[model samples]
Target: MPKGVYKLPEIKNEPIKSYAPGSPERQALKQKLVELSKGGLDVPMIIDGKEIRTGNLSDIRPPHDHQHLLGHYHQGDKTHVQMAIDAALKAKPAWEAMHWESRAAIFLKAAELIAGPYRYDFNAVTMTGQSKNAFQAEIDAVCELVDFYRFNVRNMYELYGMQPNSAPGIWNRTVWRPLEGFVFALTPFNFTSIAANLGGAPALMGNTVVWKPSKTAVYPAHLIMKVLKEAGLPDGVINLVYVGGKEAADVIFNHREFAGLHFTGSTGVFNGMWKTIAGNMDKYKSYPRIVGETGGKDYVFADVTADAKQVATALTRGAFEYQGQKCSAASRAYIPATLWDGVKKYMESDLKSIRMGVPEDFTNFVNAVIDEESFNKLAKAIDDAKKSPDAEVVMGGNCDKSKGYFIEPTVILAKKPDYITMREELFGPVLTVYIYDPEKLDETLDILDSSTDYALTGAIFSTDRVNIEKMTSRLTHTAGNFYINDKPTGAVVDQQPFGGGRASGTNDKAGSVFNLLRWVSPQTIKETFVPATDYMYPNFLED
Candidate 1:
């Protein structure tokens, strides 16, 4: 399996299942979801590859049915966070010494396990834990996670194959060295795939990791650890820790062995971590690699030539899917005055048909937001919008949290383009629209580019080829994944290569080689085939 001699296998994306009604896959997932919600599962933190059960227990419940307990996890303190870091550092020497092919095989096998045997378990747990409908769970846990594992394996192989061009007298080569110290992976709740990939990417690149998952995503994170373990991932290579972000910060950032950070969460937290790391920079062995994906005030724009149905479908799915919890979900839209009336009519009716309830209900498209904090934030935003003179609640703006944290699909029309909702990241199923004069298409692009601090994902709906090219060129820095006549949500792994810049993230492009590159430091290797016993060369000679 040595590079340059051995040919790497072609990699393709994992197919996404529709999980339509009455299908065998849907039926299987439904049965698993019911079993998971019975409330008997126990989760423990994996420190030194050994399960540690602290007395501190945290109850896990579905966001859509907050009254019922789905499971309980043992919480760890600062001691556990330190233990996990120590374990990862202890395991690094041996893990990094192992053959690259051996490391790659483990993740590829894990991908197969998720795509086949454990598919139902992964999807079901994601649905019950995150309150995602069947389709959402399938796309995220089953498909996207599989894609990250498989595609990342290919990326590893391809990266290793890169060698310097050699001349007749000598051979030059580059060896990708894993980071010198342990990496920390802090994951988020919106996508289970992210929870898996954040740690898995560093581990596959031969760097040991201390993974701390979001509190809301512990259930699915547990299953991810199980799959990786069953796939024969080496013990201590990737340790799972259940500790608060601050606890981790106190223990990890000060350690001389702290090498890198792979994070996906709030911008404020990432910024804070950056400041802390920089403050303690003198105490560390090396400058840490900080890669993150944060908040996005993402937007969508439609030209007068675009189809009303296309714009309508894009808005309905883009703004509301997964309860608009996606970092890339369209929060603001700029529509031309000519297309506003028709796009609005279709978009309103489309939102009206969406069913909001528990994820267990197969037909429900809208589920509750993650927790009460998120619910309150969204509820207040809607109330403020309704009271403002510059904004009009065009569609649903109601919220009732007695049973679960539920907020109906909402749309706000802003008289001015600079409405608060248009610029801030609501991170809920709320879309703010700003109607623009069709003649000022160029001016609207300028507004969209500067309105948000984050540059994550965006879309442009236009039938005109010239205008499409112009938008693509002018708003190049607005998003990492820019869509043409498509919604900004649902960024496919490998194909879309997700992440963004500015306040959004480092734009590592998670499913591509770029993200994996950050986990390693490359070293050049050169061999002199001929002896250079004489110090003098022809060029240096007096000839």
Candidate 2:
């Protein structure tokens, strides 16, 4: 690698493989899952490139079968987080000084390994450990994960090439430097792609990170670390440590070197972190970058002219995929009064057809929610809804946690537009439907906007182009990712550039150039072709 200009091959999104019945990928995945089930892994915390086996341990298990032991992760204390931060700062100079092309090669190699050799391992771990079906696993761990690596590198290259314009007498340029201190990446348990992107994106841009992934997602998150190491990532660049939320914050937030917080979690947690960082601002060398994607009460609005089948399919897939654990999941839906019966009929039929069970069986489309806490919360919300007068369970409210944390795909019909379930985020497979009068389309949009504080992902279905245009204009600030005729959950990397604004996040779209910008601080450099020793201008002297 040299100081010359470089060009990478044009980037593209990795194609998703459907592990249909009797397919090759399907067979390979099943074999891998069986092999993993025989023996679980022993996860360890890696600080300064050395594995630290803390005597304290936490057992990892599949959400669908809590009785089945998957593995154990070494728990970390507050001291471990402090050690990781120190290690990241120690590794900063060399990694930041490394040539951009060399850094680019590492992530590109990682993408190839994930897409080719380690694909099965990642897919299997996500399916068995995270309780996602095979297709869900492929879309998350295999396809979108690779997309993040490819596009993130491309983004860095573009960002570095954007040198500042110069005057005739001087040469000017901008240097993209890594943050002054370390970044702390806090990931969620639902999406493996998100877990990989949260820390990897910053590391790719020459920033060292201290990663704290969710306990439930440690299975696939561990495998991701292996891929990065095998691809020639240097040790001590990104230290992986697992500790409790309070323990991590007590050390990370108050530390003077905390440069940024890259997070994908709940709104409550993000808000609290923001307040802590603001309160402790004087202790840090520089203002920390706060980038996060939090909770979303997403929606789907269908007009009278919209196709009934399309509306039904969107509700089924958007509201129930991955057990409705996505931040962009369609939790509240607005349908026209005239087409409510047809849409409801289609939704009920789809619910009856969707098979619910463990992810090991490829036939099952729905799986369990993440953990016991999530399961209990969803169960309580459903039970409360059933007892309320404003809401009725249209179909699928059965819940049985004796074997696993499984909640049937439940749909609640709301008599009032501003029902409680429609406003709050439940983070499960419970959707609320409210039928709006055809003449009150504008009023319904207002209600949707005022119902929840979050503005993440949303969709609209209408055959009339006039109504579509009107909704697009009137509801411009309602959602960050707005779909015309599609579901809200499936946001592609290059095409959609996913993220949202308001309560959802900072609206820094991930998997795009904008996200890479957050990790670098620009330094503008100015040069003079000829040196000038005189202090005063000739015009001033003559005058």
- Over the full model, what C-alpha lDDT does candidate 2 score relative to the true structure? 0.92
Per-residue CA lDDT of model 2 for 393-456, tens digit only, reads: 9989989888789999999999998888999999999999999999999999999989999999
**Model 1: which residue pairs collide?**
none
lDDT of 1 by residue, 1-543 (tens): 445455546678888887787788888887887788778878999888799999799999888888998768999989998899889988999999998888888998999999999999998888888888888998999899999999998898889888899988999999999998999999999999999999999999999999999999987888898899999898899999888888988999989999999999989899999999999999888889999998898888999999988998998999999999999998999999999999999987898789999988988999999999999999999999999999999999999999999999999999999899999998999999999999998898999888878899999999999999999999999998899999998888777899988899889999889999999999998899986899877898685
Question: Would you list the C-alpha lDDT of every candidate in the order shown?
Answer: 0.91, 0.92
> For every model shown, what is its TM-score relative to the native structure?
0.98, 0.98
Off by over 4 Å in 1: 1-5, 8-10, 539-543
Task: State the local distance difference test value for candidate 1.
Answer: 0.91
Top of the candidates by lDDT? 2
Window of ten residues with lowest summed lDDT in model 2: 1-10
The list of candidate 2 runs beyond 4 A from truth reads: 1-3, 533-543
Report residue 460 deviation for candidate 1 (angstroms): 0.5
